[model samples]
Target: MSAPAVGKRQDRSGPGTSRLLAVHLRIADVLLRLVQLHALWLGWTLRGGLVLGVFPATAAVAAIARRDALGRTAEGSWGELRRDFARHWRGQFRHANALGWILAAAGALILIEERVMRAAGDGAIGVFVAGVLWMLGAGVAALGVLVWPLAAHFDARPLAVIRGAVVLLLGRPLAALAPLGAAAALAAAYYLVPGLIPAFGVAGPLWLVTAVLLRGGALPAAPAAAPEPR
Candidate 1:
């Protein structure tokens, strides 16, 4: 009787241990992927000479995240992932840069305006202008958060992609806001644990945005192209 009881206990523990190990392995796999993604982003961004590299690197990340979100990607080897990311980065170089520099200019302009406002001192007009600029900055941030994923998932020109993102933001504010909140939380986490920045910083937020957009069905089935800027 005692032997039988011991065997039953061992049987239960064996499956429990296996299950725990599986969960741990899954977590480790996810962490490894995030690390790979971060490394690729950093490498490619540097490869592009930083200024030219950031947008395409980011676009590549967004494309990969979107595919992963849609269940179109597999957990392949590291070499495979790198090749895939490089392909995306190269493919998106022209269009991504076009979109990216425009947004970067807008953000820079906002910063310049803020600095001028500060130098002007806190007058009534300055306060009002600052408030308006703040709102504009927030709008631009929201548009940016939505833009890359839209660009990645849809087959449209840069201007059309921007228009699509704007439409999605206005139409699905909650879906758009969800990723922004997640991004803020990730930023806070990176601040507390600086080491995470190298591993999960960019990929983490981009993955969250992709997942939210996919799960929420915020994207269109087939987006119609908008006219190019005249």
Candidate 2:
């Protein structure tokens, strides 16, 4: 009787140990994926020469992250993911750059406005104008934060992508917070660790955005078809 009881206990322990090991393996797998995705993002960004590369690289990562969040690519191997990401980056390069540069120009305009406001000196009217400019800057940043994910998930023109982002910002404002918070947290972490910037920095926030949008029903029922440059 004692021997059988010992065997039963061992069997129970075996399953528990297996479960724990499985959990650890799953975590390791996820971390490895993030690292690989980050590497791809960095490589592609540098390939584009940073200025021109950043947006398309971002779109590629966003697309991959969206697929992963939807479980469409959950079982995809790293090679498959890399291939898909490259396709996205190349296909969307022109459109992504157009979208990105437009936002960049807007950001520059906002900065110019801020400088002008500062030159106006500290007065009641100047203070009021400064507050309005700050709000405008925040709105532009929010649009930017939402736009790449929209572009990745939608096969639309840059203008349409901007409109979609606007609709999402107006309609599901609360849902937007998840990705923004993720971005803020990642920034804080990178500030502290620095090394993580190259590993999980961009991929981490984009993945969170993709996941948040998917869970909140912000994405279409079906993934957008691969877009072609027009």
Error (Å) of candidate 1 at residue 2 is 9.9
lDDT of candidate 2 at residue 92, scale 0 to 100? 86
lDDT of 1 at 104: 78
Checking candidate 1 for backbone clashes, the offending pairs are none
TM-score of each: 0.85, 0.87
Cand. 2 TM to true fold: 0.87
Residues forming the 10-long window of minimal summed lDDT in candidate 1: 221-230
Residue-by-residue lDDT tens digits, candidate 1, 4-35: 99999999999999999999997786677778
Candidate 2 local lDDT, 1-230, one digit each (tens): 89999999999999999999999997887678789889999999999999989999988888887777777665767787777878889988999899999888988998898889899799998889889989888888888888888887778899898888888888887777777776778778889999887788688878877777777777774764745333
